[model samples]
Target: MSLRAIATFDVSTGGGVGHGLATWFGAALAGPLRGRLEQEQQGTAFFSASTRATERSPRQEYQPLATGWEAMRQELLHEPETAHVLYMREHLGKPLVHVRSSTIRVRRPNAEAQLLFGADCGSLDDVAFCAGAVEFLVAALDTVNPAFAWLGADAPASEETNLDWVLGRRVRDSVREARKLLRGYSWTTVCPEELSVRLGGPGALAATGAFHRVVPLSAGGCDPAGDRDRGGVHRRGRARCLRGPAPRPAARCPAVRPGPPGAALLPRGRVPLPRVTDRKREGARHADATARAVFSG
Candidate 1:
């Protein structure tokens, strides 16, 4: 089964933390992840596009481009080795923060090569690995630079919410939805850099013999990368482009902290992330129940 889900965050102006931290975090985690990437011949990567490239690819097939993100799904399918981290040229430009630890595997009969997310397509180890990468990246980034409050760095009142936390919220939501669709699968835990506590779930694991794709938050089209710059460094102070609803004041919600060992990171307390089914809103109910139980018990 092909299971996919997306969790999107509306980054406020100047919400993007500087690229310097991303670079530093990427390098620090690269060495530990190198062993895994070496084993698979490809570790992990991040991808984004420029406003100019995104403008041209709106109608393209197999690859879609929205002003928010430039999809490289097709290119990734063709060049798995090309995976690398990317920061958008415009910090407030609605960036696509994609991370994957996937590899090329041959399909049967035609023996066609394809790339799928989640290491080994859903093994316990695969789940652990994917989770580990996300955990490390989120922790490193959030601690180093939380997402800036709405309206950029100069906003007089700083919002308690950061980019990493918001991004993690989206990821946790998506994983909850996917898990509902993919229950009874094997599970594993990976905490390479003690970041899993920050990400919520350990990782989504693919079951044995299960052929699947882990499409995290992505644009709607498919074509691959073209003769465009893969990633670009942008200067701050660009015009603002708000796509989603305005973020509420952080004061409205309590701050989220790093969750405990083997627990999902939520503002309230420890609870496992859920898979969202048509009945999944019940999952939210259940999550609330569980949180209540934890507190009340």
Candidate 2:
């Protein structure tokens, strides 16, 4: 199984976002991640180049990571419709890490920039690598300061699956709703561990701040069900009565029947969810909202 960790954030269509991402990527490759990779005999140099896979010519020559990132940064700064996929591997057909980015465009308003780290865990060593990579990526969330993010075990096959499972909407509907809600909203810091605790373990986490909010979705609550009727579609329910002072009013809380082990739902407009789907086909999709009832009894 391939374990993946993703951090998605709201960024302007400015050159600074690209520059900041490039700088962070380079620093990660040369700093903390360097020692971890070295311990596994997969040093930073092993990821020497970036491979751009295409449909017509899925195979393309690789370029040094520095070169590829620099080129991507430039394109992100200058090109409004820039969409690129850069992945690293020991050789062709064996991907270890992936990074994709695109500038915000008018055509698709819900899109957000994402930094993903993944590794296929087939053996003990591979599991270790995946663990290390996930740890680094999750820790980097504080630095990246994403509006919303998630870490999962198996990657969803497509954007539709990701959206349906995470937000309980199809791609088109989700994007439209997100674009509408995203306006007049700002970004804030979301702590993953803290979110996990607040959600009562295994559900989407959303919290309000003075100006912004953060939501963290967990694997257990966000996993998809096999039954189509239950797949990514959550049913509304009343909160269970609890003793002591409630976080908020139970009557105000809107609850959803938590799915099996891979899906969670947040009330609409809780926080801006990143459209971290396929860029080539879908462009960019974003959604935003505040969850006032999420913390209710």
Candidate 3:
């Protein structure tokens, strides 16, 4: 049977302790996660579910998920990879305090691919940090990503799920109401980074190549070297033309034309990045039509 893949990422970094410390301040067990990214390939995970799922147990103690993201972010520091460690330190601002949770959907790979929800905290600096972070991320992932996680990151089943345990109380309430419609055991560890996760299988390998081609416009006046890397920078700032009345000196619109590899300028303004796949197509279709109608009316 086909399964819908859901992964949530949590990127929250504020305090190093609190009821949250069980998750956040928990230091990572000393030692690197062993193995480089390409060498490790992936973490060890079992792909089979031995326990048959049924209704969630009543009186099932519920753990408080302040942001739902904290649980996952901490886990990222643990386990393999010098590159990931360096990558986190480099971009996330060393001693990264930021937390981000994301989920990526890997479709039935034309090749071999599986959806796995993951969490990593950029704040982790020690072993205690790893201890807490691991359990939390594992909890969120096992609960949401059906393709990965047999337990832990997930609780067997709860009343369905929540994408955010914080900043999403309304959604959580609505989730409770929606529970009446779902059959089978509803896993409820709470998927937090639902929005930032990827969704596609090996089908997305195409995306890796294509994403590079999408080239972000240098609107913020990027460095000259950055321009060289991003392919010659395009005009910065907003545009008022493109299809409007006419070109006037007051019109801040810059022209767009085809150029050589390093100089190709896409239609000057903020080009709405194109949805190159079906998953992207779905995301593009989610605009608030009712709100749009009201605004237009």
Which of the numbered candidates is closest to the native, going by highest lDDT? 2
Prediction 1 TM-score vs. true: 0.23
lDDT of each: 0.22, 0.34, 0.20
Residue-level lDDT of model 1, residues 1-297, one tens digit each, is: 111111111121012222222322243235223333233223133233211112234332221122122243333322232133322223334322323211112111101111113222232224453444333333333322221101011111111112222223343333223212111011111121112223322222111111122112111111111101111101110100000011121212222333222222212122232222222322232222211100000
Candidate ranking under TM-score, highest first, comes to 2, 1, 3
How well is each residue in 9-38 modelled by candidate 2, as lDDT tens digits?
Answer: 334212234443453355445533454344
Q: For model 1, what is the C-alpha lDDT against the true structure?
A: 0.22
Structural similarity to truth (TM-score) of each candidate: 0.23, 0.45, 0.18
Q: Is candidate 2 or candidate 3 better by TM-score?
A: 2
Any runs in candidate 3 off by more than 4 Å, and if so which?
1-169, 173-202, 205-297
Winning model by TM-score: 2
Model 3, residue 86: distance off in Å is 24
Task: Kindly give the stretch of ten consecutive residues in candidate 2 with the minimal lDDT sum.
Answer: 221-230
| Better lDDT candidate (2, 3) | 2
